[model samples]
Target: MNEFTLTADFGMTASDNGFIQYGIHPGDTIMFKKAEDFPVNGSIVAVIIDDGPITLKRISFYGDSLDCYLEGGSSRVAPIFISHAEYGRLKVLGVAVSVIHSLAPAEE
Candidate 1:
């Protein structure tokens, strides 16, 4: 079985970066399983860009690249496109399995 970690900080990290949509709040707890393979299309992933802090994004594979979106589903947020060459610096920490939303209302 893949190991997973529950962290409220992970939610807060994403929230702090304006990933407050998709029901993931600053104080919410999240369960993330360690990535074993490249995620298929439309997987919610935790990625670290060029040694930067981790961020949660929905990734969709393109021909030789990928697009990362802050919010998934009906939201209209623009995606951040990553080219093939940049893949070397991108680290996929894991895939998100579920979220436990915070009781407190989110701050706008």
Candidate 2:
């Protein structure tokens, strides 16, 4: 099985960044496998669009937009909006089956 880690922050590191990536925080880890097929609604998927960084989110297909909910995210975290017109750029890399929160103390 192949695995992917956040070897590079890509300058997007933040508290909510981790929440959107998995659950806990940055430095935390998760295990996933290829999505194989387009994920259905409510499925946690690792996806990317328009050559952007990969992300983990629960997918929901809307009429002209793709609503993606971040797993274990706070109410303040906004859902990522992707227009159907950009669907061609959507790439589902894998399904996150498990998460491992970083045990290190979080900094304020």
Candidate 3:
């Protein structure tokens, strides 16, 4: 079998309280790929926006709105609303495949 290694454009800083159950934390490096590689309304993906800051959320398309929200980690958090205009610069950056964790203890 041929192994495909997709090159990542950048990494996101995940929050500890957000994805601790998934073993992802604030210092962890989450690799990403070009948006073209993944499907829209797919699973958890890292989205880069030109008008707003980059986000790590589950993406779902509803007409012109891309519904982005916390999937398994929280209930109180609200979903982000992005219209088609925002998607003009939208890039999936691929789905989160794995995380490079920062195992060092908290700083003093």
lDDT of 3 by residue, 1-104 (tens): 99877577667767555666666776787776656654556466866666566677766667555444334445556666666555566666677766777788
> Considering only N, C-alpha and C atoms within 3 Å, which residue pairs clash in candidate 1?
none
Task: Give the C-alpha miss distance for residue 41 in model 1, angstroms.
Answer: 1.0
Q: Which ten residues in a row have the lowest lDDT in candidate 1?
A: 8-17
Q: State the C-alpha lDDT per candidate.
A: 0.66, 0.60, 0.63
In model 2, which residue pairs have backbone atoms overlapping below 3 Å? none
**What are the TM-scores, per candidate, against the unseen true structure?**
0.64, 0.57, 0.59
User: Can you write out model 1's per-residue Cα lDDT over 1-108, one digit (the tens) per residue?
Assistant: 998765432332345434455666666666677778877777778888779988778887775445433334335656666666667778988878787777776576
Error of 3 at 63 (Å): 12
Which regions of candidate 2 are displaced past 4 Å? 1-23, 63-78, 83-85, 106-108
TM value for model 1: 0.64
- What ranking emerges by TM-score with the best candidate at the front? 1, 3, 2
Index of the highest-lDDT prediction: 1
